[model samples]
Target chain A: SAVISQKPSRDICQRGTSLTIQCQVDSQVTMMFWYRQQPGQSLTLIATANQGSEATYESGFVIDKFPISRPNLTFSTLTVSNMSPEDSSIYLCSVARDGTYEQYFGPGTRLTVT
Target chain B: QQPVQSPQAVILREGEDAVINCSSSKALYSVHWYRQKHGEAPVFLMILLKGGEQKGHDKISASFNEKKQQSSLYLTASQLSYSGTYFCGTETPGGSNYKLTFGKGTLLTVNP
Candidate 1:
């Protein structure tokens, strides 16, 4: 299991502002992903943070809204751009080790837009 | 597509048992289970591959039926610490193997 941590554990932001969440893993990993959990909703995959390339986003989610960057194997960032009240959710980052079937998650970033 | 989990919510008493089911419409390569406490990230429980295997940890066991495109998690002799929301993440073939589509979790509350 990998030890994952996210910055800005909880934050309150004004509408129209952008906030970037950072995920850092203690050890190097091959796969990193970003997920969102709305209030009382299931976890939704926002994108796959590919190393040195653009992230693969799921339907209903675009890069313009949730841009992600994976600079290296142990670190990644997800930026919630032009945020709105509806964008408030707990953003999580997860990492998967090579040859393993489990993915470990970070202590999610809870964002509240006012 | 996202997997569907049954028994949206259930309550179990100590020493009792319960089962949670997850079903997908498409063929699945794997099914992963996780348990999340309130305000915490989901913790990995177990993973079942495509070969129709059953795995367990302590009193928690799970079975995967590739033909039925479904999986079931069984908790025997429930403990109070078992109270949490359970989620099943499904992985399909022909895409990023690591990408997982999660189901709308099942809430389990084990009472004394």
Candidate 2:
């Protein structure tokens, strides 16, 4: 099992502002992932954050909108740029632990863009 | 591709049991189960790899049917804490890639 934490448990921001959510893991892990969850909706994958290379985004997401940075093994950040009301959702970070098949998730950063 | 889960919602009483099913259109290398409480992130429950291995956590257990290309999460003796949305994520067969296509979700409400 892995312990993951995210910054800014909840926040409200202006429509055009940007927020960077930080994710930290207690132990070094492989394959960090970012996700988005709208109210009453399921989790949607945003991208896969690689340490040294560009992140691999999902079909409906782009780097300009949700930029990711994985500078090291234990930390990563996801930035929601120029947020809109539609982007008001819970952003979560997940990491797959080594030597195990489970993926642990951070508490989540709940952002309400108005 | 994403796996399909059944029973969009379900209501159960304390101590009752419920089963959530997840099936994929494509063959899966592994299936992962998670539960998300309201206003929180999804918590990892268990993972079932190919070869019919089963794992359990407390009263919750899951089985993977490799031949059927499906997996089922069984919540036995469910408590109010079990009330949450359940999601099944599928990992396709390939190399060491760590991508999981998740299902929509199954909302479970456990009442007293």
Candidate 3:
């Protein structure tokens, strides 16, 4: 199991602004992913952040709106740009360690866009 | 594609038993179970690979039926601390990338 942490556990941001959420893992991971959970909704995978490569985003999500960066194996960040009330949700970062089928998640960053 | 999990929500009394099911339309390489308390991140419970191997921790156990392309999580003697949303994530065949597509989730409420 890997220990994961995120910056800005909770934040209140103004509409039209962007907020970057950071994820760090205690151990090196083979893959990292970002997910969004709107109020009363299930989690939606935003993208897969691979080290030294561009992140692969899922359908209904695009890089222009949610840019992701993975500078190294243990660190990654997801930025929610041009925020709106619709973007108000909890963003979680997950780490999949090698040899394990499970993905460990950070506490999550709760963004309330007003 | 996201797997299908049911029932959407369940209410159980303390010391009761409950079962959560997760199924996929496509063949699965693996299935993972996670539980998330209100206002907290999802915590990993267990994972079952295609071999139909079962793994258990504490009173929680899970089984993967490769033929059915489904998995089930059994919670015995449920406790009040077990109230939370349960999610099942699956890794598809071919293993191009190991990322998992998670299901909508099953809301489990264990009342004392």
Best by TM-score: 1
DockQ computed for model 1 against the true two-chain complex using alpha carbons: 0.92
| lDDT per residue as tens, model 3, B1-112 | 7899999999999999999999999998899999999888899998898558788888999999999999999999998988999999998988556688889999999988
Clashing pairs in 3: none
lDDT agreement with native, every candidate: 0.92, 0.90, 0.90
TM-score of 2: 0.94
Give the least accurate 10-residue stretch of model 1 chain A, judged by summed lDDT.
A46-55
Model 2 alpha-carbon miss at residue A96, Å: 0.6
Off by over 4 Å in 2: none
Off by over 4 Å in 3: none
Task: Give every collision pair in model 2.
Answer: none
Which 10-residue window in model 3 chain B sums to the lowest lDDT?
A: B93-102
Candidate 2 chain A has its poorest 10 consecutive residues by lDDT at A96-105
Top candidate, metric DockQ: 1
Report the error of model 2 at residue B78, Å.
2.1
All candidates in order of DockQ, best leading: 1, 3, 2
lDDT of 3 at B18: 96
Predict model 3's lDDT versus the native: 0.90
TM-score of chain A of 3: 0.96
Please, what are the lDDT tens digits per residue for candidate 1 over residues B17-104? 9999999999999999999999899999999986589999999999999999999999999999999999999999888446899999
